[model samples]
Target chain A: MAKVAAELKYSAEHEWISTDGSGPSVVGVSAVAAEALGDIVYVDLPEVGSTVTAGETCGEIESTKSVSDLYSPVTGEVTEINDGAVGDPALINSDPYGAGWLFKVTVESEGPLLSAQEYAEVNGGEL
Target chain B: MTENYTALYEEHKKLGASFTDFGGWQMPLKYSSELAEHHAVRKAAGLFDLSHMGEVWVTGLEAGALLDYALVGKLSAIADGKAKYSLICNADGGVIDDLIVYRFGDEKYLVVPNAGNAPTVAVALAERAVAFNAKVEDASAITSLIAVQGPKAEAILLKLTAEAQHALVTDLKYYAFNELTVAGHDVILARTGYTGEDGFELFVPNDGAASLWASVAEAGAEFGIVPCGLASRDSLRLEAGMPLYGNELSLERSPFDAGLGGVVALKSKEGDFVGRAALEAVKEAGSQRKLVGLKGLGRRAGRGHYPVLKDGAVVGEVTSGQPSPTLGYPVAMAYVDVEHAELGTALDIDLRGKAEPFEVVALPFYKRQK
Candidate 1:
């Protein structure tokens, strides 16, 4: 089981969205996803200014076991990419909810996001 | 489909190991962290439950001759208590399975094959044994294998053995075995391992596995030994440049292509063996593809089935690869066109659609100091 932040909204695909009620929202993989991935070795991020659709794959995450696509949880223009996470992949495993945010997208259309309790249930259970 | 479990399955579950399906067996993927387990093997010691590996017993007066005819290596000449790495090849010279033949006596040998290939290897050996006086017995069901590996492996192992068997543990050379009793149970202590470190593989009965693990774990406690899983074993083998059966070796390629031709004892042996003619042709004409080592230029590691490119054209494919814990960079084993297999050659591994730069380095990116 992994910790789910009550303030963050999560997707079934395991992306967490931290939104301040509009504008740009920071997105990253949830702690549940990061823990399952084991030591993340590389993160391929979508370029800034690129258009991303909700529920679509925008990038990839490579771990020792295998590579997985990083699905976008909202449809918007990629305003910023986390070079820090890209430079150090282990950050995703160490601080998934904080410094490990993948990218930031400008406000646009988005899909249904689950609450902390719902996301915890969706990912097996809370730790 | 339900996957089979090893004798140590309960032990792994008790240790909170995350599970993965490997070669039809429900195995531990990681007990804690793969990197931690890998580093433990390199610095101190690590325990591995290899009960999934297949063990076939070849007994009778013609056992040696049967192995010589079935496998690529000449096993008949191996002295007692010695082991030789060999390969079982189809008549077409394609490798069926790469195995280690341990000669227990003049008429008794144990052929250990990878978990998934064990049944096939056993059937193949039994088929070849029809012409000889040997009996091939699949003893995998009742046997258990545990490996203790690292720099402190010997000292830790010796602490659990009886005083009289202390010399055997200390004097055992690489690739040698000494059968003896330890912790009140019979065990075949083999000085061999997959990790690029000094290690010992203890082969014991299935019922004795738990006790053996307990005793070894207690003795290795001072050495900081951790129970490792297949993930660490895979990364460790990749750093050592060892070929995994499903990855680096397959029926699509011959032993020569994998750079394992040295193990084929064609020059030292006489008489026809399985795949003798096809292997001879390959030996004479030379292999079209060669396995080479690759060092990644960036954080991204090349994975199996990724295309290997040279000058914008595809020349080969990566077989086995991973981010090496010991070296801190990614390393890979790949089969490339013979022309592109030279050392220090600039090449690219296509990760998804992008080509990542790499260089062909020497095999075995890491080797332990003697």
Candidate 2:
């Protein structure tokens, strides 16, 4: 089972949001999503300054086996994108929480989020 | 329906392999990173469990004649211990399945078909052999196939066999097999692979599969033999420009359309064969669409069923494609209009909704040093 950070809040779509709730919150795919995706080769991230809606697809994540949609955990403006993850998508597989953070979002309004224990129960991850 | 499991399923599970449903079987998709497995096959070696492939035995004095009439290849001409790549076609010349027929002796032959098409191919072969003095036996359930493929394949096998049989293992010709004792188990070792590398495929009974696999893995540890799954197998074969049954070769298209006209023996064989007239007519009329290779000029890859276009007009469709792990570029095989199938022709593949620039190239995108 993949590790679910108890410190972060998760969306049903598998995105993890840093719960600082101040300024721009860091966002990345949960470890469960990264492990399920296998080796990610390409990441199409939402452009900076673009407004994204929670629970909607903002970009795509392509792996060798298949492609998946990257959904937004909370409605917000994309404050900054991770160019490093875009250049080397494997980082998302190796470090889903640290260097592999997808983007920073300026939270406008929050969407329904789950606690780490709830997410682990829902998605078969380990808290 | 419940999925079937190979004899080595427990072993794959023990190795932490991710599973996928393939052709009604619970097969391993990957153990770890697909890219790592792909590179292992290219740089060192990779072991694969191919027990899902169907193996049908044809025997009797008329076996050669039965196969000659049933398939597109002249099976009677192939020498003993040699394998010939052939295809079984419907009466209308549509490919039912591509096969590898190995002639073991004068009255014995084994036909290996893709996993999904195995049952159909077995039934068709049995039905086709009714008139001839031959019998078809579907032995897929009782058999297990293991393949060791890469540059160091021979060395790995050499470590398992006795010293006396070392020369036999090294001297085995491509597309040829011999009954050899490997790791104290009797297996038919064949020098053939789909990865476009020098490799050996061993056909052993199901009872001995797990033991054989363990022995090979242990012997190959020093040589860097990783357990490969279907994911790496797909990318590797795609880079080699090999066609997948459901993707490239299908009942909707004939062999001629796939640029495999050579496998269809019309003038050389002396007797009538299945789909002879239709394939002859197809040959005379020529195919409207030809299978060609595509090299992506951009970073994004074109996947299966994507539309191939020329100047905003649809010209073809991609059958199998991915970012090549060996070539480090996107490679694809597609059936395109004959005019757009020429080498060096610039084309575009619709990646989702966007058009990605591609160019028509030769069939294989990568080749080994040997």
Candidate 3:
């Protein structure tokens, strides 16, 4: 089972967002998503200045076995993208919550969100 | 419908493997990182549970004659311990399934088929054997297959065998099998693998599968052997430029279309085999679309069913494509018009409505040092 961070909020599509309500919210794929996708080889992220809509696909993730769409959990302007993850997608599998963060977004609004415990219950993850 | 489980299913669960429903069986897709597993097979060795593959025993005085009549290859010409790669085709020359036929004795042979097509192949063989003095029995349910593949495969096996049988491991020829006791279990060891590596596949009864797997794992510990699953296996075979049954060879395509016409054995065997006339006509007409290897000029890969284009016009379709883990680029196999099948020809694959540049290259993007 994947680990779920208690301080984060999750979406049904498996993206995680920081709940600190700071300047910019940190966002990434949850550990569950990374584990489900075996070996991620390539990641296509939205541009830094691009705007993303909640509950919409914002990028693509390609693994050895298959390809999957990366859905956005919040509607916002992309502030920055994780170049390290873009260069080596395996980092997402190794450290999904910290260095493997996909992007930082200046959130204007968020879609339906679940707490860490809720997410762990829904996705069979461990805290 | 209820799915089937292999004898090693519990072992896979213990290793925290991810499962996928393949060919009506719940099989392991990978244990952890498939990339790591792929590298392990290339650098050291990897253990694989292949019990899902179907095994059919064809025995009798006319076993040789039956296979020669049923399959495309000249099975009777092969030696006692040798194996032949052949295809069972329909009357229209379309391949039903590709098989590996192993001759155990003058009157005994084993036919191994892919998991999904096992029942169909057994039924087809039984139907074709009515006129011949032979019997077909499906033994898939009672058998288990395990493989150790890589450059270190032989070294790992030598650690498992006793000094008396060390010669058997070292002297085994490729595409050949010998009866040997491995890990205190009787197994039919064959130097054959789907990955483009010098490897061995062991056939044993279902009851001994778990212990044999554990013993092999323990013996291969020093050689860095990881338990591999179907994910790495797919990439490995693709990099080796091997044709998968459902992907490269299919009921809609003939052997000539896949560049495997040499296995048809039309001239050497005088006995008329199944699909002889249709295949003869196909041989005379020549294939319209020829299979060719494509190397991506860009980072994006062209996946299956993606349209291949020549100067904005659709010319063919990609059967299988992936990022080659060993070669560090994207490789694919596609069937294109004969004019565009020549090596070094430039083309574009319509990858998700975007054209990506590709060059036609030779099959088998990777090969072992030998």
Model 2 misplacement above 4 A: none
> Model 2: what is its DockQ?
0.77
lDDT tens per residue, model 1, B129-175: 99999999999989999999999999997788889989989999999
**Candidate that beats the other on lDDT, 1 or 2, i.e. the better one:** 2
All models, RMSD in angstroms: 1.7, 1.1, 1.2
Tell me the tens digit of each residue's lDDT in model 3 across A27-120.
Answer: 8999998988878888999999999999999998888767788999999999999999999898999999988899999999999999999999
* DockQ list for all candidates: 0.75, 0.77, 0.75
Clashes of each: 0, 0, 0
For residues B202-287, write the lDDT of model 2, one tens digit per residue. Answer: 99999999999999999999999999999999999998888889999988898999989999999899789999999999999999
Model 1 quality (TM-score) = 0.96
- The TM-score of chain B in candidate 1 is 0.99
Candidate structures ordered by DockQ, highest first = 2, 3, 1
In order, the Cα lDDT scores of the candidates are 0.92, 0.93, 0.93
Quote the positional error of residue B247 for candidate 3 in Å.
0.9
